[model samples]
Target: MDIGVALRDLGQVDSTALIERVLGFDEQAWVENSYRQKQYDVHTLTESVVMIFTDGKGWPNIEVSKESGWDLLADVAMPLMHKIIERHYPPGGTIIRAMAAKLLVGGVIKPHVDAHPSFHVGHRIHIPITTNSRVRFMIDGKPNRLAVGNAYEINNQKQHSVMNKGKEDRITFIFDYVPPEQLQRMQQMQQASQ
Candidate 1:
């Protein structure tokens, strides 16, 4: 699977609520550099990420060696997060990480594959809150634009990159989870469509 579908509508949820909460954070709250900063510092994609939920050790620790914990920001964003989880995931899907990622205009994420063990075999879902047509999320060279309020499952295991050529910032609520059957079903659906 490449650029995936919206699997679920997710249209009724007010995406602005999540966007407002994300924007409420102070400048210092955003994690400017990607975790793999050493490798691609020159063309680094700057994202203002507010980690709402993460492994116990906190942000930048993508590998969950222990139990997970909700950050302080999660309290403010819990209502919307629950709504998202309920809509997409099963009763007890394992949520590895959840964050509000904001990319500024002209920002670009150089092509790279997230090859971590945590990323493999899991689904990375994006719920775009504020975005425009110029925001291109490329998966294996094909460009994809996720409209506001819609959810998309991106195949992060493949080489992918993002560029926001629009004037407004592109904000998305990203969630990583290991669904028992939904991921398999989505892949099958993609194959059938192809």
Candidate 2:
């Protein structure tokens, strides 16, 4: 259960299309509906997330017992996303949830653990599309910055939080997947090679 604190880099991908797509959206397109943590009543931290693929209910609802389906907006952006997913995740794994999360300038996600079964049973992968050095992601109280275009595997079962102190919004594509045993073996091989 101790997955270590190092950020596992899954290499980089061309995030041009993804960044363009996100930047093209209207200002009102970002929806503020996240159940991960409660916004502070005194100092509200505005954030938003769009579900591209999910358990079929909708955004903000992480618990689902049904098959995953794409949202209408996701259908339109599936081509690029599919390419990214296929290149990284490939097939044979169960991807329970996928979304594009946006943290506005000066926003913060209070520290909390994603204790849901869905989060505990899978690995959370993050592909930062647009980010800056000021955007900090804290996992178990350690702050880390995910640079744009790089893919990283995060241990979401641990206590984590995000803060956007940059002047621009921080956007990232996140996916939850139950990785196949083969993938684990491959990672072990990689570690041995190192």
Candidate 3:
């Protein structure tokens, strides 16, 4: 579905500062081990953090990569996230299931579709920081470079992939957005017609 005409600008937060804090993170805490697929070009990096959020019903995964430790949803990052949620998914709406944050050292996620459940509700959004121009968002068989201060909405239900061709590690804050009621209604109608 196309983005609504009345798109909202989630307040801008200090992207650099937030990333700095994330890099300073300490990984002493023992969390569940993460799953890494061999399909994506994997490599070791300075440090990275993967955080997952579930809205109960749908899958809403958000991965925030930093130069080091992961610092996401800081006071600065909150506003933008809230605005995104408000603009795309209504309050208390959607069933967010999982989120992941991966740090790529010039790594690439081979072109592929996300898990089936992920395609049903939310679309993935990426925020590039500390990343070089080599990083690209391949959506619908087209490559789109993510601009640092700009937000782009992606239909994960469609085909897409991530690539970081630069030498520097690319950190993208990725998350999912669910369609609001009106959009959902239209989706149902379209499906019924088909």
Candidate 4:
């Protein structure tokens, strides 16, 4: 499929209401995790560095629990997300997950692939809430800065990473989308191939 078609702008979502939902909202209600994997550039595992909204199982250093990250999800991000998913993502597809991440002054997610070995399909999308020149999404080994008013679709199977060289914090909205066809293919591949 055309991965480029996968990335589309859903207009400006960084509205006042959205900002309020993020800043004023309670992070305690949602599930989150703290990650200190060396691959992600964890200089000090002791310090609270990362937070995520995953199922909370795989990684070793999980800082915030996914249960607590639920409160971190914002309402304004939904409409823009829906517009993109409804148009491109396959039927029966759901935004299976989301993450509200913080990249501090020195925080960095080292070069890696977003796709797991389990599934060689689907799409990885990102919405930058706050970013700067230092923060980047390296797709296919090429680095890209998150521009305001732009949404990005990344080929997670390719090597990627993020770097926050600036002093201010960088936050982004991230999630996964599965095409029905790809999901069915995965099931079939699992049943027959296995």
lDDT comparing candidate 4 with the true structure: 0.53
How do all the candidates rank in terms of TM-score, highest first?
Answer: 2, 4, 1, 3
| Alpha-carbon lDDT, every model | 0.63, 0.62, 0.50, 0.53
In order of appearance, the predictions have TM-scores of: 0.68, 0.69, 0.61, 0.69
140: Cα error in model 2, Å: 2.3
Arranged by lDDT with the best first, the candidates are: 1, 2, 4, 3
Query: Candidate 1, which ten residues in sequence have the lowest lDDT sum?
Result: 60-69
- What lDDT tens digits, residue by residue, belong to model 2 across residues 1-194? 12465366777777676667666766555554444325333124543445533442322234433222134235534555456557766566555666666777898877867654445556677878788889888888788878887778887767778888899988887776655664455456557766
Separately for all candidates shown, the number of backbone clashes (residues 3 or more apart, or on different chains) is 0, 0, 12, 20
lDDT of 1 by residue, 1-194 (tens): 23254233445565676667676766656654344233445235555453533333322234442212135346555666667668766755566667766777898887878755456646687878788888888877787767876667788778888888999877777877766664465446557766
Q: When superposed on Cα atoms, how far off is each prediction in RMSD?
A: 7.8, 8.4, 7.2, 5.7
Residue 193, candidate 1: how far off, in angstroms? 39
Write down the TM-score for model 4. Answer: 0.69
Candidate 2 positional error at 78, Å: 4.7
Q: Which stretches of candidate 2 lie over 4 Å from their true place?
A: 1-3, 32-46, 52-90, 180-194
